[model samples]
Target: MTEPMTDLPCTARVPADVEAPDRILWGLTARQIAILAAAAAIAYLLWRAIGDRVPLAVTAAVLVPVAGAAAVLALGRRDGLPLDAWLLAAVRYRRRPRLAVPTEPVEPSGWGPVSERRPLPAVLRLPATAIDDDGSIAVPDTGSVALVVATTVNVDLRTGPEQAAIVGAYGRWLNSLTGPVQVVVSTQRVDLSSQATRIADAAHELPHPALADAALDYAAFLDELAEHRDPLGRTVTVACVAPAGARGEAVRRAEHTAASLTAVGCRSAVLDAATATAVVTAAVDPFAPTDASWPRTPPNDPVTAARSS
Candidate 1:
């Protein structure tokens, strides 16, 4: 090995203003400047509209709070949403009492910005034109893409040292891959009652009655738990997308991903056409039901019996 050279030429220098992360206005940051400027603009507009009829003192009194509130709502985030969003929530929250089997709203805000809540024509937001047979999403503007959605392995369940080891291994594994992969975690409200029912049913079909009874009791317990609990479920999915013309490449990449996941001691399933559609649907509307709910008639109901008969 060659000895370390003390005289290495330096080729790189830090760019100017790189340390200043955000825009500064006068002595304050941009957000502060925006708030002040917006409040002033609101006050000025209001003064021009009604200054002739109203006294200056009355105008100032009304304008101060209104302008301040507007500025804060527009510039600040509350509950991870702008304060203006709380206004639209009022309508949805009001309907809470009327819900039959209440499902949590997808968005915490359950609302839109107050200024944006004003009457305006609806806008088309979905860019996707179709979902291809190979689970590719087709967008007229952006073209086709095949995607993979996989489950997440829990790191918290492992011990501290194990977690560190896993992290190191995962880092290495990530380094091995050349393409882009996105990790997404969705917080959902899932209805697991049907799965529990199936589990209990399968258990009851076994030879031992005791085991069957125990399984049923456990399923009932789980059902109760779901009803009483927060209903929040976190699903982790890793996704990779390939272009429309490259379906084979997408599948190859997905297969490699599956093998990597298996090597890491994690279970993962790639989404099929239908499941991918549902996942996309849920992403767009998180409040969408995790499972289908079909109507069932009461055992003693006359109309149900009449139809069957």
Candidate 2:
């Protein structure tokens, strides 16, 4: 016995003659085989039902097993796997390692007890841009002002020659003004639904049905009257007077600008009606005239005490 060769169980090797089976009956994954089987069954059932004129019961019998297998496969494939799980896994797999080292923890100084450091409140940390209501970019304070409002005008439609004269006057006024002006036009639809509802309400409150109907009819007539009467068309022209300073020169410049605007068909007046009235009154007061020749006082003192008297 050549030193009696005893093979250790752990060290024993598989025999070369022993081989794994080349064909496995259940080698296909649960999903793959089920899908293939389902497709074949569906094809067979369709052919039998349509081509062979089989009854629905027989067709269903063939299809039910295929459908069941397909459902089971689909359910198994989806089981416990959320839509974002794969995406999250991929992101984690591809993430780069951070390069920085964490700071070492240190004991607090003996000034006071160590307090927990909490992060700032989210509201306080929000950017100023996020605080704006209109979501517009912040503008620097440039010290500019603007006033906007609607305007009304009474048109004089007397004669063609009158219109021509007015036009000529307007042209002169434009020649006189020194600054730019803006004109705005807008239209709005009047809502009659509220009126209709009111009429209906009144009709309902009438003592008799006939009276109620009559009242509703009257309301309808009123609504029609409002709708048909002079469909309101609006045009707004602004005579913007921007004076650099509130001093006498600014006032004179403003007046000159206004006169020029008036010559062009544009009516220019000081925004403050009272101030314009006072100036005009002072200029025209005959009793308070400083000189007999001119119907005006010094531009600086338009409203002198004598003129006021």
Candidate 3:
């Protein structure tokens, strides 16, 4: 007998503006209200000062455009932030130093011409100050972060019940969050040269001549595809940050989060310090070689000074 479909416990229609700020008055946020109120106060003050000297029509003409601009700045959004915030960010970006260096900048000696003395290079400050031996990242004045790499599962291919189960599992993880957790999914260009080479090298080890020829053909095909097309790979990583003074807790949280996510059919593992360093380095510069040793040395920790004679 055919069974009727039942309601899914995990599925529901969520609004698009779930993260939108709460509307305090007349559908405007607190920030929007504050901006409008400030502009109104300024306009009122202008009117009080100019009422005797200036004509009302002329004053209105000058204030109308200013009022409209203030409304736009308060109500409009650009690049996911309010217009005022975006403008502030643009101003900050323009004011920041053009040149930056990894090493700390030293003040120039008082012996050179003012024009000849170049602007001191700005010290580059990375989000993470250091990578501990146990894989925790030291975030200056914030907390420690631990990275866990997880495999992705395709929910579209799953049946209705299976999809619901996966959703429920994911919901559990979301509900369990006490502190900040970031799930980063990134795609990068993949180089298939090494893979082709490995396959080609192992082609002769096959038992049958036909199998060996097939492997060789596959290797050649891979080389041709790689040359003709750009292949990309996706990686999913979860970064769990523990509060200040609880560095070790970050690692435990990462492992626990990995275990919790297993219900959704994702296989995950916590990255060790060396592997985490490599991952971070690769993210900063995708064109750089993966096995570079420079990333192993954390910022401000001079390798030369630590060397024993």
Candidate 4:
């Protein structure tokens, strides 16, 4: 066997033992390889076209690889390519022309110096709930004390004396109070639907059929009027009486003022139904000189009675 060593095949004699190359001279991705081939063909065509005027060999060698690399770079940028391998390869190729090692050096610490000592920005604290809608701030409740609804009055339109008396009573009522009071005047639209319905029922029961149509027409008219008219039309003037002291003291003072007005022969009540005149008389001695005298003439006009000392 030793004497016939030259007769053996290369693989059989060497036992097929060999280390594979880490990188190939023409190492490239499928796309990169295509781009490089195209660039080489273009360079060859250009050289053939202008070979007589220029050095074709030198020009092809210099420009073909550069054009291929440029095309590859442009394609990589457009398509999100892995740049780490390419970059390492380039760096290795630059460092060692014939051979290259792709291993990166380990830093002394876990991370780089700049990354280890980077400063962080300060954080700001804010309240958990908002102030506007949350209603964290306290607010005072401000509303009217009570509403004084006026009573209805009817005067005899035919009798002049009765009308005058009613007018005089109203004048007295107006002058009796010394505070703000709201006067609400409301005018409501009339609805005749129930009346029309009653009429329709009556017509239906009757022998004649014409009345039923008339009743229905009347009902329709009434409904139309209601829809067009302002049902809740009103003119309300609100009067707010704010007392000077505490609630209890204010009520007492108001009662006293009402009594004083009644002493002048004006019809008034401290709190409804109870007469102020009796209240005033019972509160003070009848023989006391300080007590106000009863008016000789009828205190029908509150303004005149109020003007009297």
Query: What lDDT would candidate 1 get against the real structure?
Result: 0.63
lDDT of each: 0.63, 0.45, 0.83, 0.42
All candidates' TM-scores? 0.48, 0.24, 0.81, 0.22
lDDT of 3 at 283: 85
Please provide, for model 1 over 1-309, each residue's C-alpha lDDT reduced to its tens digit, 9 standing for 90 to 100: 998644323232336864453758566556556767777887898899999999999988989898778667656666755454565576667654442322433332645455454222233446676665555566565445445545566776766656666566666667666566677877887776775777787995878889888888888887897778856677766666555565555556666776677666677666655666766766777776554222222222344334554
User: Which stretches of model 1 miss by more than 4 angstroms?
Assistant: 1-125, 140-165, 176-178, 200-208, 289-309
**Per-residue lDDT of model 2, residues 90-201, tens digit only:** 5776673333223433545668765785332222221111101111112133111111223343335434454555556655655555554444344433334445556778
lDDT of 3 by residue, 1-116 (tens): 89998655447454698778899899999999999999999989888888778998989987898799999999899998999999999999998998988999889777866766
- Can you tell me which runs of candidate 4 are displaced by over 4 Å? 1-145, 150-158, 186-224, 228-232, 235-240, 244-309
Q: In candidate 3, how many clashes are counted?
A: 0
- Return the candidate ranking by lDDT, descending: 3, 1, 2, 4
* Over 4 Å off, model 3: 1-10, 13-15, 107-117, 194-225, 287-309
The local distance difference test score of model 2 is 0.45
Tell me, by lDDT, which candidate is best. 3
